[model samples]
Target: MTGKRAFVTGVSKGLGAHLASCLAKDGWQVTGVGRRPRESAEVSAAVDYLQADLSSAEVIGGLVAKMDAVPDLVVHNAVTYPDRAAGRPELDTIETTMRVNALAPYELTLDLLAAKPDDQFCSVVVINSESVYHADADSAVYAASKAALRVLTGGLAAACRSTNAAVSTLMLGPLGDANKVEEIRRIAEKRGATPAEITRLFLRRSNPDLVIDDFIDFDACYLSLRYLAELGAVANGMLCRLDGGSAGTLV
Candidate 1:
């Protein structure tokens, strides 16, 4: 991937930041977009950081203006993780999620593809979630938004078939995070059980064949990016599940 250029969204933190760092280390010129500045100086130095609120349609033009050229790879990883306890989610919440998780990426993909030269091979990677397949009561809206994105990804792949662009969807599972673990612990305490026991029960209920060991970590993002980068035109429309086989029949 040396000398290749990549545009990554949500690089201020989490998996997006990690992916950007990895790509820069591999000699890819990376441009990161996020609403806030990167917290880590080390990560900030690895890529050209651009602050833009992806939830709004107006941010698209500003984002494009910052890019030097159409990138070889585009990773859509930005998202809005709404609190499930917010009670019967408001319409605005749903709209914001849809705009940020689905529409923004779709628009950006189209814009980038349109700007690319005919001979350049561009790869678009959408970071999807397991919620699309395993929906729960609390995450109804979130799941729906991701499902829409999954559909959009399929359509984008088909549209790019006759061009030099390729689209890949990475359906991700649980990633390690202290706050998430704490949240699970709190829920487990309320249910009078250990975190491990609660987690096991939840996994079993979600899918009987799924094991707790199937959850992915930060490294999975890196692996997925590498796979998408190496993928040729023949594998343009691939929807890969990086959930350690836990998706089971859903895939």
Candidate 2:
């Protein structure tokens, strides 16, 4: 093991699960936090699990206080977007969304920073999303929360300039679900076109020269996060976008 500690939130599924597993394989001591236990046995074997609802500051504070080791890397990956089919969200919806998507990271990072030794190194990575740039009717609340997170992360970077703490944000594109590949295959059969042909047309709509999947792949995302984690204090205040395509790997 590298003997480095990594605390990752939202490890129940998707990119969170993949990241936890990847880091564990790379010899980092990983602790995964989620609202519930991980569903995948493989991921469960990769890291210690901590279950806590991120919407509650009290719960997050308690969680942080109970940590036995200072994490070298802290990944704020948990997020929530309320259903907004009925148009503008109610006041409660906004509160809940902000609590989970924005406030949770704020409270968690501050708590971790405060608890760490003055000279100890820590890297804070907030897994922001592209939705923040393209807030449609269905995503206004989520985007607002992410925007708030971006600003707060920048503030944290400044606050840590004289300290050992580092903060960075990874704004990401839509992550491709594995199921989308199969769905595209089915669509290809119906259209009497190869999957590659269909995917090419799909790419053209976004970028004519792009032929790869539109969603950011899990492996690439992991590489980018790993880069920031290893870069440590040098990466402070960095805001990077991983589009899962031509953006390429940071490694």
Residue 170, model 2: Cα distance from true site in angstroms? 1.3
| lDDT (CA) per prediction | 0.83, 0.81
Over the stretch 1-251, how does candidate 1's per-residue lDDT look in tens digits?
69999999988887888888889988999999887756643354879888778988889756776688999999999999677767887888889999999999999998899889999999888999888877788888888999999999999999998899899888887776556677779998998988887766666776665656434677877987789778877658888877756677645
Clashing pairs in 2: none
Q: Which stretches of candidate 2 lie over 4 Å from their true place?
A: 39-42, 84-88, 200-213, 244-251
- Scored by lDDT, model 2 comes in at 0.81
State candidate 1's TM-score.
Answer: 0.88
Q: Clashes in model 1: which pairs?
A: none
Q: What lDDT tens digits, residue by residue, belong to model 2 across residues 96-172? A: 89999999898889889989999799999999976666576778889899999989999999988979989999878
Error of 1 at 185 (Å): 7.6
Clash statistics: count for each candidate: 0, 0
- Name the weakest run of 10 consecutive residues (lDDT summed) in model 2: 242-251
